[model samples]
Target: MKPLLATLFVVWLSACGAPEPATPMTQAEAVSIEEAWIRETPPGAKVSAGYMRLVNAADAPARLIGATLAEAARAEIHTMFMQDGMMRMRQLENGLEIPARGQAALKVGGDHLMLMGLNTALTSGAQLSLQLQFADGSSTNISVPVKPAMGAADSHAHH
Candidate 1:
């Protein structure tokens, strides 16, 4: 009877030691950009900001290399960092990364798309076409509406 009990204990231990199931590897479905919008910057400003939600349904990580919009002469990835008690925006030369099965948000005072050389003011309710390039040699086109800049106090709001 003792030997039988030992055998059962060993079986239980083996069961407990089993490895967890592996995450399946599947082709990454093209990412989707939702609620894309350019903030309404003041007239004659050299820079404006854009924000959006990038959803990556794929099982692997992906990188967003660059973007383009008709309203801006150039688009770039930018990040805000606190330096010497001040928030400063800097261009991200390496681009943005979206984790597997996750999402990254481009919002104010964080990772955002910079719209440089704005030809016109981004008035509320105006829509613009933007193109996003990915690391996999694929790209996506999205239509984004212009909106008022989020107030300083309300910048943390998320969908």
Candidate 2:
């Protein structure tokens, strides 16, 4: 009955196999990301904006220092404001801060990510990767889905 005993031991070993452990999460990955999107622009538009809701759940504050994308020459943090009855945009120097346990919104008509020198049109449904750098020496890469411009309802599939 040696074969029978060997089979029983094999079954027991298989049944007692250890469960796979979960991978560790980084500090940047622990940050909350919500409603992240990029505006779809027409051909020759040259520029586009990205918006998102960022929440810092850590005990310390977080700062968004810069961003990088392959499709754009450069990206900058900007704030849109009304000045003298006219809308204007300005670069946010020294980065933007998100207080601990607080939220920072990069949305339309306010703070946003400005993409400049676009190599091609940002059509709706296109999937692109953007790397957001923070002051803590950590960065997170996000896959952003392109959405139609404001007031538009076209659903372009990602290529």
Candidate 3:
């Protein structure tokens, strides 16, 4: 009887060690984004910048092919690089690649989404909607708030 009880206990422990069910990946659920925001621009400025960290949790690498925003006449992926001792920004035609299980950052003075021909001032605390297109025919709509540039000194604060 003790031998049978030990056998049953071993079987129960083995069952507990079995792997959990794998979660299905949905197009709507595959990608995750963080720290998405649009920088606050001065009044009457023609262009502003958008920044975010795009995370690809899927099994395959993903590409950000394009983006659209209602507040701007046009939106394009851009990269900033030093050329001939000058900082220059240019549109990326091929799209930004985000490796599988990795992240791509669109930050200030680096890779960013350029919003041109602004329809209105991007004031602080205002939300902006953006649609991002991916190579896998998946798209995501994100709402980002406009915030002051990071590390900008407050002018109202006295020394």
Candidate 4:
């Protein structure tokens, strides 16, 4: 039929033209991040913290293996716990995970990202750039907003 020949000719022309741009797929794309934010640091402070909620849409779990922020010289995945009636914090050697079809949150007084050795002060209403690495070997860049302190933010200040 003329219509069939026309469709075939169109397909042949498209195939002969420039190929579509190839973009490598990232396994980490199955996980989505939301509510990402960092706490504003006080003057002369060398450290700050950040949090986010992750939702995994994949059938397998997704691991957040590392993070980095240009504002800080170094970044670490950390957790807070009560020890001997004193609040203490430690780095998570293995990072964090979002269960399959579930969610995870890095929140205050809980699992968080510690940005240390700050080269500059973080003020409220400022925007920060953060990069997150996953166990699946994907690195995702996230823009985080510096949020003002909440009234309930009373806790040990980072050193």
Point to the candidate with the largest TM-score. Answer: 4
Residues 121-150 of candidate 1 have per-residue lDDT tens digits of: 778888888888887777878888889887
Worst 10 residues of 2 by lDDT: 150-159
Candidates in order, TM-scores: namely 0.75, 0.76, 0.77, 0.81
Write model 2 residue lDDT over 69-156, tens digit each, in one string.
Answer: 8999989998866678866778899777887779899887788898888999998998999999987678999999999767533222
lDDT of the candidates, in the order given: 0.79, 0.82, 0.82, 0.86
Which residue runs does candidate 2 get wrong by more than 4 Å?
1-27, 152-159
Q: Candidate 3, which segments miss by more than 4 Å at Cα? A: 1-28, 152-159
C-alpha displacement of 61 in model 4, angstroms?
A: 0.3
lDDT of 4: 0.86
lDDT of 3 by residue, 1-159 (tens): 999999999999989987988865644356787999998888987788889998888887788978898989998998877778866788889888888788899888789898888988899999988899887677889899999888752221110
Q: Which pairs of residues have clashing backbones in candidate 4?
A: none
lDDT of 3: 0.82
At residue 62, candidate 3 shows an lDDT of 82
Clashes of 1: 0
Q: Which residue pairs overlap in candidate 1's backbone?
A: none
Which scores greater on TM-score, model 3 or model 4? 4
In model 2, what is the error at residue 117, expressed in angstroms?
0.4
- Lowest summed lDDT across 10 adjacent residues in model 4 is found at 149-158
Top of the candidates by lDDT = 4
